[model samples]
Target chain A: MEKMPKWADVILIPAISILLAAIISGLVLLATGKDPLNALAIMFDGAVGSSRAWGYTLYYATNFIFTGLAVAVAFHARMFNIGGEGQALLGGVGVAVACLYIPWPHWTLALLGAIVLSGIFGAFWAAIPAFLQAKRGSHIVITTIMFNFIAYSLINHLLVNVMKPAGVMEPATASFPEAAHLPNFHDILGLVGIDFAMDAPANIAFFVALLACWFLWALIWRTRIGYQIRQFGESESAARYAGVSPTKIIMISMILSGMFAGMMSINNVMGEAERLVLNSAEGAGFIGIAVALMGRNHPVGIVLAAILFGFLYQGGTQLSIQAQIPKEMVVVIQSLVILFTGALDHMVRSPVERIFLALRRKEA
Target chain B: MDFLLLLDTSVLGTTIRMATPLLLACLAGLFSERAGIFDIGLEGKMLLSAFLAAAVAYTSGNVWIGLLAGIAGSLMLSGIHGLASITFRGNQLISGVAINFFASGITVVAAQSWFGQGGRTPQISGAARFDPIIWPGALTRIRDLLQANLSTKIYSQIISGHAIIVYIALLAVPLAWWILYRTRFGLRLRAVGENPAAVDTAGISVIRLRFGAIMIAGVLCGIAGAYMSTALQAGFVREMSAGRGYIALAALIFAKWRPWQALGATLLFGYLQALALRPDIIEKAIGVKVQVQLLDALPYILTVVILAGFVGKAIPPRAGGEPYVKER
Candidate 1:
């Protein structure tokens, strides 16, 4: 079999898979008696039709970037960190404690403090599973999944029994101080004499996500430790022969993975909600898996993938609300995208490879 | 402390009841993992089957039909997993994740279209739901056989009065042991996991064996789901299986992929569920505060501890997640 060109491998394969997904999703809509064109139009309008929608889309994308990076970083170590949901949950707790306890005078200071705290929290949550996978024979997938459940229960316990103020029936904790509430894009843009949506949750967290993309790119490609992680991920025996410690690589990879996941809470907890709430991490954790897979586990690929998913999420919600499509149908579309790009990838690859091979054979 | 309440037959009954779903799912995972396919969509399969069983049973007014439909639904999904992973040689984990999302979305959409009650099936009643087996007039028989002792009768009640599926689930452990260890197919299955090439050399088709294992896993998961909707409860609800599938996978790991060990692990988890259901019992008995959520988290925490403590023993099958390829 002939190896495909890098451009095709990086761009064309995902594009074809996604196109196939869109076609199949259209068929699914048609089968349900909904107009595919109408659904498509509604989705487009909902996602990027206006500045407000873009705000929601970017806000959602911000969360996905953190989680997607979490999965991608762990992927470098060949570790499928399925515990991002749990790690992100734990990150929320860190944000809650930091925001609720420390009274920062400015939003900038609070953001910095939350970053450190969330990194520590996310890293701590991921460290246990990483440590177990390194030291014990436990599979990371299984352990991380189990940890997701534990994280949910822990967060639930804290919200219901510990954090809720007295006489409040609601399970969420009290709102954070004003300093902790990060400024949204509208607020920032307003300062520069530009009009923007006021209530949109899109905040400085999106910039942080972009920074993370750069950080990951540098960490994976430019640094010696990054080289060691890649080597360990590619082949443990090769790394071990080169005197790299397996335990250290595994632990560090997972901790860094967790830190990224935890930082996601800064977007939801501090940026938008301005308080700790149950399920603030939402399904962004699982969506991260899809993001990582579809992005081919690359930082640039992940950023683009995050934006695409963000569009889908916002658009699907709009379709469901306006077009009366079932809310779960969006999930079905998400599944199809991953199923084609990640699971059934060879379906597109082998045919392309065969064509390329045939062309070469013809030339010969 | 009301020790008696804590030890009540009703509590034990609830534990056994709750354990039924986990037990079936654990067995399902054992079969799949033992054949070298790491099937993580057990929850999805269970959820699908649960929905089908309840929907069918409610519509047909026949619990048996519901069970069959549920099994078929689950098998269909497992077949997809096999096609993707075994045939196309895709990543089993990703395929499993995809199918899970598929099941979650499709079921809710189908449910709403079919029943029109949000994402729930109509509650089943009469002959559609499984009731206690009763074991051929046990009240009179027990009185005559046991001289009407309270403890003896209560003990029988704890052990008996379960739906027929519960007994089937319990009996399956030994059956799983027989097929996995004693049968020729069992030997081939084990060999396939350890080294698929060796199985191929021995004139056994690795694809067929693995596909069969995946199908069997599906059937078992279907039963697990059907039991929940058609037996334990009367209808299906969205995300009804919750994370019982993951709990089962954890139990399977805790057991190290042994059938009998799977039973022990599942029952232990079931006990934890029971404790979670009634945290006050623990609080009263131990004279300390008990967090139900923490109790719910025990399986995950214990699995970690066990993994760390017994690292060597917990290793999965050598080729569990790798897609088997013929010699090239």
Candidate 2:
């Protein structure tokens, strides 16, 4: 029996949790000798006061959406794929290789090829840990954490020794060919006769992120494999008894998760930077965990959560620039949100459930 | 001769110094995990304490006060974890992740506000930091030390000069073993991790035991953080824990959660880190250019291999990662 209505479970609890997080963030600001109200006003203005702000906000959102879906998919199988950071790093390598090495006639074809290679690269990274977990009983959490470090080291080696263009001091690859350039929001919006910020990195990749969210929704709710994955998540022994292969579910879910995380490079690496840079993932992989948790692991919820985080990211930059407040203040807020929604959920949940139960009793 | 030089006292000293934090953090993990609580937030706790320790030590000019401040900071974070995971029966892993993010962010934010040195405390020196302790007669010329014997050289070079915390970390291993095996509290703690329901039926308070374990972890992590900032580096740098907490976790698994084995595993990892720091020696010895990243990634890779059972199985506590429910 559900102790709370669906609406309350889906909306009310998250709202309250976010409110608590905000309150705590305010306290942190005050403790640091900053005015909470002034900070909030600045953040609000920088996040949504202008169309250009929306452009930056949406660009950041696009990255979070892809990574969040990656986390959400693995989470459906009750697997914690924290290596989204590492997987996305490898995905950037894939995008770099495809765009830099392949001579593409047009941007559209290059995009397709980059997507495929990135997915392959990300899935390949994820598969090893999945295999270890399936066959050797290694904990996925620990293995994935290790893989993140390995991926970082690999990327560092490649950037410094292998990938840097000749005579370039920075440890990043040369720019991709102009033919592979992705149309930014300015160009994409111009196609429909809509004026947009010229310099904002938001691009067609945003639509691709939306498409992924929709596709994941269908995959999780409309496909047989999704059912099997969720079943395995619910009870491994029960799923085994129902003739579902635990190994198959673990492998498929993790690969799909990796693919989504890898594809995130499309937005950040190809669309925004137009080159592969070190630490290009920019902590979005970890943000995806917070997104997935806050979104309740649902597609629509993830999109909403991703945008909220995007606002935080954009606003945080503005805060650092304009108010002289360190940008990591946003990280403190994000952590509190994760704590309230993900870890201390019952602290809010049980009390809400009791209130609902009492209301029902009063009605009776 | 080159290979023999690799085993010299200076290298051994470096290895011991490098392994101190790992040993402390690994034992911290041991206490927490043994009591049915899986703590991935050791990194955050250590980072927070490292920052606070240095900050306080700089202000107060007392290393002991800084150590206490560090412990207090770690304890505060541990309390939050206990509230989320133990009292509220929430997800332990998520709580850990949150604590890590919180520590990483708050330290930088606070450091910028207080010191304004781009997320680092002022470089501490003299009275504010833990200086290396040199034993009597060890500082004398090698020629005067017992006819310059290798044993005398080893004693003077390898064992005599280290921060006092290094000795504490080494002593902690035997102390951990004794507390975990010889004491009644240790038996109950292990039992709770294996079967919390059984422990509950035996009239032991599972919540209190888990909280006790977590508190102990906080104290050890506090010391580890202090060692890093005040003893090892002389100040706190942003993200200075530098994944040692994770490496310590890997060491915990590599040791199969045993105290003595943990010492061996941490020393091995420490040796690898020391080797990575001296790439010139490695390149000269092997006649090959070995990337430092390779050695940096070796411990994680080795842990993965161990976890995969190629080396041996690393089975965690039977009831680890679960919030004990009276009903379930």
* Index of the highest-lDDT prediction: 2
- Tens-digit lDDT track of model 1 for A1-364: 4376788888988998989888988887777678989998998898999889999999999999999999999989889898999999999988988899998999898998999898899999999988888877677887898889889889999999999989999999999988787889998889999888887889999999999999999999999999999999999999999999999999999999999999999998989998998888978888898899889888889999999999988898898789877778867877887788877888778888778778877988
For candidate 1, write residues B1-328 as lDDT tens digits: 6566667555677788889999999999999999999888898999999999999999999999999999999999998899888988998888888888888887887787788798899989989999887765455353464565666666566666899999999999999999998999999998898889999998899999999999999999999999999888889999888788878988888888999988988887787677678877878877888777888787667766665675356678898989988887
Off by over 4 Å in 1: A31-33, A190-194, A362-364, B1-7, B137-151, B310-312
Best by DockQ, which number? 2
lDDT of 1 at A213: 91
The runs of at least 3 residues in candidate 2 whose Cα sits more than 4 Å from the true structure, single-residue gaps closed, are: B139-149, B309-311
Error of 2 at B252 (Å): 1.3
| Candidate 2 overall lDDT versus native | 0.91
Best by TM-score: 2
